[model samples]
Target: MARIITLTVNPAIDKSTTVAGIGPNTKLRCTQPTFDAGGGGINVSRAIKKLGGTSLCSYFSGGPSGAYLKQLLDEKDIEQSITPIKGFTRENLAVTDTSTNQQYRFGMPGPPIQEAEWQNALKQLELQLNKGDYLVASGKLPPNIPDDFYVKISRIAENKEALFILDTSGEALIKAAKSRVYMLKPNLAELGALCGVTSITDLDLKSLAQEFLENNDCQILVVSLGPKGALLVTKNEMVQVPAPVVHQKSTIGAGDSMVAGMVMSLIWGKSLVDMVRYGVACGTAATMHHGTQLCIKEDADKLYEWIKQQAPILETN
Candidate 1:
């Protein structure tokens, strides 16, 4: 078993293609379509694999689409443990308009999970984890699942003395934060939602991040700021990682890849500052790819060096 395990409660088959242009009620000719097994944790696992690390990805799947998702993972040589549900897994579509150079995404709600099915999935996770391991719970919960699902799983990791890294939003994130997780990865918007702030300007981001760390027992907070970069906040210090300016082909899965890079660095005993640096590299790499294609190892390494060269000095007040 790998030392790191990622949990994604809701998964999907993501299909993407390009069209000349997009307009309402207009016929559009799509180019070749691409598909990938997608979910927050799954993308993290994929990014980890790209960075020459291994992690087990656990998620829920069912019916034909689920079967295809499993096959997709197999093709990527990714290790996975999927809980079989009754309904078919959902499919998400992303269409890029070449003429306008704009991308549009259509997402479908995933299949609803039953109580017994969810319990069985938890049992599977319990069987895999042990002391000193790391459990990464990412993404949203499906319908009929409790909001505190990650919280319950965090307790299990706690019982085993494993580190629990939570990447989620809304009530699920709030509930899991109450468990005093090892790390919480939230974008600026999600952080604002948690802090009741509508917009997270550069001047207010650091203070807001500190407030969350103070109020919640969270050990570390990583607030992603998109083009502005990410802020890493710990009890003792705060560091802002600046991303390199790159021509972005896609921004999807950037956060997941960033989490994977940070977690991998942590497992390797890297310093928090270096971890955030590599995280920025991973995120930048993800944007260099098209559609759902995540960061490649070479891109991550190249960007890592560039980030280290311009390392941001952290302050401790």
Candidate 2:
């Protein structure tokens, strides 16, 4: 089997804590806090591991926090390749209010990357990639990195005959879309940003998704709609996969888990429709857990069956 590889240029230590409730100027007693290695691609790799799959996760790590991130990944038994740099990685905080069941996230900007360090990371990625492998480049581009970084990675994938998957937003996504990619996963907001749409209701989502596939070199476009489910758009067809209704604990890693599920299914040569079905299942399962814990294999299996039973018949325009 071809190995799965995930690249995250900007990574962080995700710390999540729970309190009874949240209010301004209120002294809240936080419950036990949880910390995990995080970034879009890292979360996907973690989710893949939770789903009984293996993946190689590569990212930019720097300073003391980078050491901790590597240690955390090591504890999880997730293989990784780190491109060490000078500045420390950023930390993200997530506060979950138990009383109202609301989750608030505070994210910080990552360290700036030197040109040499950025180029070195790209060289490492190119050297490691092989034919038939799956390469997922996700997350925001840190300052000092070129906007066309993903575009360069896509070209490397093309040269190696690898399957390239992109999960990003704005200019980075637009630039990467110019290359031939195996798949692109974008949340509703990101999709709207890509299509220059201010608001995307259910009515116009399918059309917008089709427009992307037609206009870009993307083979498949996956648009996630949180609890509403997701739409899978290909050149010839489209499918609507509904998320299983569940009491959500936190939605932090849901989208990343969805990408993991989809890529895992694709690596196994599952049909595109089945890939979306399992992706929704994984995403829904992730929301049932608190903190950075991703979708478990058992939950994904159960939800996969449920999603298949409730799958919507999509009408393509």
Top TM-score model:
1
lDDT string, candidate 2, 1-317, tens digits: 69899999999999999989888897989988899999999999999999888999999999889999999999999999999889899899999888988898998889999998989988998899999999998799988899999999999999999999989987898778888898999999989888888889988888889988889888888899899888889998888888888988989889999999999898778898899999999999999998989898899999999988874777665
TM-score of each: 0.97, 0.97
Give the Cα error of residue 294 in candidate 2, in Å.
1.1
Q: How much is 18 displaced in model 2, in angstroms?
A: 1.2
Give per-candidate clash totals. 0, 0
Model 1 lDDT at residue 86: 95
Off by over 4 Å in 2: none
- Residue pairs whose backbone atoms clash in candidate 1: none
- What is candidate 1's lDDT per residue for 32-94, written digit by digit as tens? 999988988998898889889989999999999999999999998999998889988989999
lDDT per model, in order? 0.88, 0.90
Indicate which candidate wins on lDDT.
2
TM-score of candidate 1 relative to the true fold:
0.97
